[model samples]
Target: MTTAQAKTFITLFLAMLLTSCMVADSTPDNQWRIVDEGAYAADVSADAQLSVVSGINNGIHVWRFGEAQPLFQWSHQSEGGDQSNNLVANVHISADSLFAVTADREAFAIWSLTSGEPIGFWRIDESSIRDVAVSDNGRGVLVGRSNGKVMFFEPESGRRIEFLGHQERINSVDITPNGRYALTGGNDYVAYLWNTDSGQVIHTFTHPSRVTLVALDDEGRYAFTADSQQKSQIWNVQTGEPISQLQYIARQKIFTDAVFSKDGKYLLTGAPSRRLYLWEVATGKQVGEWKVAPRENMSPPSAVVYGVGFIDDKHVLSVSSSGLAELWSMP
Candidate 1:
């Protein structure tokens, strides 16, 4: 990064600190539920029909909308200990909601959503797992590691392909629902859209700072990549061209989670300061904005939006670090 970019990043970081320190209720109106009190991590399926949450007290639990009881409950065994002591730091569910992955620092476990069974558990050899994603139908798993390596593994066939293009530790990763493509961002200030079959790069997206987050459209039409600084852009998945960069009044708007609309017309993003935004894909305009609630007894009065998905053309869903599942009307 250049000196100019470094100055811009510091300005943005201080702005975020000032905003987060404020006490206010920015939450918009919504129907909400307490899925898990003090959730450690959470994720929602692409269709918004299913959710998985891990709390401080228990293992991971998967819930179907409108159902009081969780559909499945599973736990990852902590290193040198039982499942009861595991603290899952990351959780991801497939777009089809057929599979989920839960991980800590050293290992990750894959689960089948339909039968509520543990499919497999794997431990990293020399590197720690940073993030993980499962392909629809449980055919593929993508694991980003702390040692600048990404693994594309097949559970049934026992095949593992490594993507070693990154020069620094990986930060985030996502896989296409069909398991054909992979997107990953890293501290190296670059994001790659690559073929999972051949381990080849199709497109490279560069940034001014470390790439913090990334996501892929379920239909493989678009890709979203954001850095720690001010740059957040969407790209054409087919043409490998830049589409539009998101516009914000702040020095920067850091996204913690993001998802593309099914029709590939809009993008939804969530941030640390209880912010949720809807952006027009073609024009890169801010068409809608909403905020999720912080925990009731929290000091800072802010929540990090962990997961977002479209319920339909008219509704949307979000899961937050606040341990609440909220349903919002489309704006």
Candidate 2:
């Protein structure tokens, strides 16, 4: 082939293989791009402004979309005294990227995303916290616990609201952008949504087995739930009616985390199967699947992913039990 023709053909192939938006039954494996490391992330989340990761490093870290390094990090470990090695279980960054909240084994804390300074901290009970969610403006924080209680903390006025969220330990939780509605999933075979102000259960969505994760779209109009039996369902928040039920392309897998895209067009799922799956929220159709490359020297067959989220419509972040944290984007 002519030199110019060869160059043109190579460029087209590279574009097709490198971008995350490649429309296929499965996204291109060549799209893999390891953007960050060092922390074994337990949960990863983002909004338009910032991306956050948390895990066994006993802290949460934040970064802008294209930056190679995190702007700041917060740790649960003591600086000097007892050297308590605490693990951060979950974290969420608000949509505005103004603040972030985290849940450790014993306490929940909020931090200023711009300054990297903590805004507030609270201790609810002896049981470790399981998950946390923050509002877009950073004033409201929802902290879920292993004891089945959901604690709402208002950092500005120092107010707290406690709700009996579930009969079993809470596993996942999320809040709407306006901070008016929140969703929780627990060891119980159910998911619950509550009016944050009145502290009342507005809807109860039951499953065949324990609910492992729950999430809401940016507008708070749609909710997603994944249960232990490998079923994932989407519902209309306003009506509490079933919208779409997503089935795994393969055998049943234990879902660890799930989230909707910023615009609510797509859904993401993480499982111990070492695979990440994306679906169309409107049709419940599988659009993409990316498996974490097997770790070096590890004999296990799967990567055991614990968390998955969209940094935006074009990028994806993942955290695994094997200490793998990475980012992939549409080239």
Candidate 3:
């Protein structure tokens, strides 16, 4: 990276670290801000400039950092829009807020946020698109297929780089903040890290159960992996060594999402238990746990924290399976 780029990253890194030290809510109800609700999926950009919200019947929405209403929305119009509920899928927005990608069971399309029109529209594989992520560079797109193959795309070059490793459906794929590496986990019980540019396998971590989610820290130095069972481990990205087995009092066997703090000092894991667990990266010890539910209403309230990302070191943004979005204060 150039000096400017390095400095920029360093500045952002420090900002995240400082945020982790924030003196905010000691409890969920006291210190959290609910940003959205009634959405199936949502993701915040790396820079937190925009948020992508997916709905069962309303299609997709892109909103600015502080806006309550979306700047744009898109939906399907076939079969009286009934299947639109099932058609709603994952959404990814570039850190620079220049492009957005929305994926459903059938196809995933690229849209120019500035132009408010699609730039690329195509299917990834014979099966559904399980997960999608945009490289930090905002130009490369990484997609995991339900068939277990991962594809890398460049909008300008129209280059599709494919990597084959897993045997079952890929559950999640995450790009390092520097955009140098891609980490993936699948139902095949394996997690693989790929060189984003070359589409080459860098490291493969095998688990005892089906791999459900994988995440990389901002600098790509560490990767987190979780399986369908209550198993989670941290790996050294550079050496492919298992750093430690993350031990926690997890009520659910299936973990849905995981993310590392920007400083790489802490890790967060979420599951169907309607809670997020924070672990100390150095010791692999559970340091904190927070329930994800917004209130005490227990009418089928065991919602999973399906999508999670660090908005800053001190705050986190998460989307529950029931479609509620909240900006939560970190401990």
Candidate 4:
């Protein structure tokens, strides 16, 4: 072959090899089991024993792993006098207690999962709460509101502890295991760490773009945040030092939600484009990617995955904007 032809052939071969690698890296080794469909929002508990999903006619449905149906259902609004509710934004479960925030800027309510009765409800500021995080011990709860505020509440005492920080809508909030510090991320492209007891801002980290999500590791030593710019960062919680940054393929828009595995060895991130990525915490390497196909029976994809959480190191729960929830086993 001519030298010029040989060079062209070599280039084509390399291009094909790179394409194959990308495909292989994105394929999932395990299958996704759909637990629920048509859910607007969903959350899995820290123990991974329960999942709460809300959307449309479904209100809030609580399910335990391996169960065929929901253990309990709660609605905010009544339909046909049958007690139907709508517009649930978030749900959280701790032990036998369940907490939910509705779409309307009204109140946050708590319920007893065992008895299926309302335990109590607290009126939050008339701003829509977008996300919430509960302390590992379930003593403290942090609510992120649309009005750029983080409200700390002690669920057991029904007392509001603090209202502080953020100049724009808070997208996510995370509390450390010991309940000493809380982290808030907002549309202002900043993430702030605050002292839970004193309600004081300890340090603020700026991102290149809007902050979409924030999470703290099990040991509370590392803080992770991601933005719409497809960049994920890790910071040393104690010194407020940047540890590492990972970039993903950019999309038109990405709802970046991240979680640290139970072992704190892996970080999982979900994007808008039906792709989920797992990263190694120590080496900052991409370990796996799961590709979810768009629902062939529907007009669009199953739904843009809103959040991802590790059930253990081997299993994960992914919730979509359309309210479809799934559990995947990681290899």
* Count of clashes, each model: 0, 2, 4, 3
Q: Which residue pairs clash within candidate 1? A: none
Residue pair clashes in candidate 2: 19-331, 20-330
The clash number for model 2 is 2
What's the best-to-worst order under TM-score? 1, 4, 2, 3
- Tens digits of per-residue lDDT for model 1 on 1-331? 9999999999999999888645455454464554555677788888888889886666677877656778877768844666643678889999888999998877888898899988888878878889999999989999999999999999999999999999999999999998989999999999999999999999999999999999998888899999998889999988879899998767767887899898889899888888778899997888877778886688967678888888898877888878777777777
Write out the backbone clash pairs for model 3: 19-314, 20-313, 20-314, 39-323
> Any idea what lDDT model 3 has?
0.71
lDDT of 4 by residue, 1-331 (tens): 9999999999999898778545432333343333334556666665556667675554677777656777788765432332422356666554223443333344566566666766555556567777776664457777889898788888777677665678898887877765568889999999999987788888888988889888777566689987767567888888998877764443433545666776777878776667677888776677877765443356754555655777676777766555445667786
Compared with the true structure, the alpha-carbon lDDT of candidate 1 equals: 0.86
Model 2: how far is 31 from its true place, Å?
8.7
Model 2 lDDT on a 0 to 1 scale: 0.72
Query: Who is ahead in lDDT, 1 or 3?
Result: 1
What is the TM-score of candidate 2?
A: 0.80
- Among these predictions, the greatest TM-score belongs to 1
Pairs that clash in candidate 4: 39-323, 77-84, 77-85
Q: Judge candidate 4 at residue 95 and give its lDDT.
A: 28
Name the top lDDT candidate: 1
- Among all windows of 10 consecutive residues in model 1, the one with the lowest summed lDDT is 20-29
* All candidates: TM-score: 0.89, 0.80, 0.78, 0.80
RMSD of 1: 6.5
Which portions of model 2 show Cα errors greater than 4 Å? 1-38, 42-45, 55-59, 77-82, 249-251, 301-315, 319-331
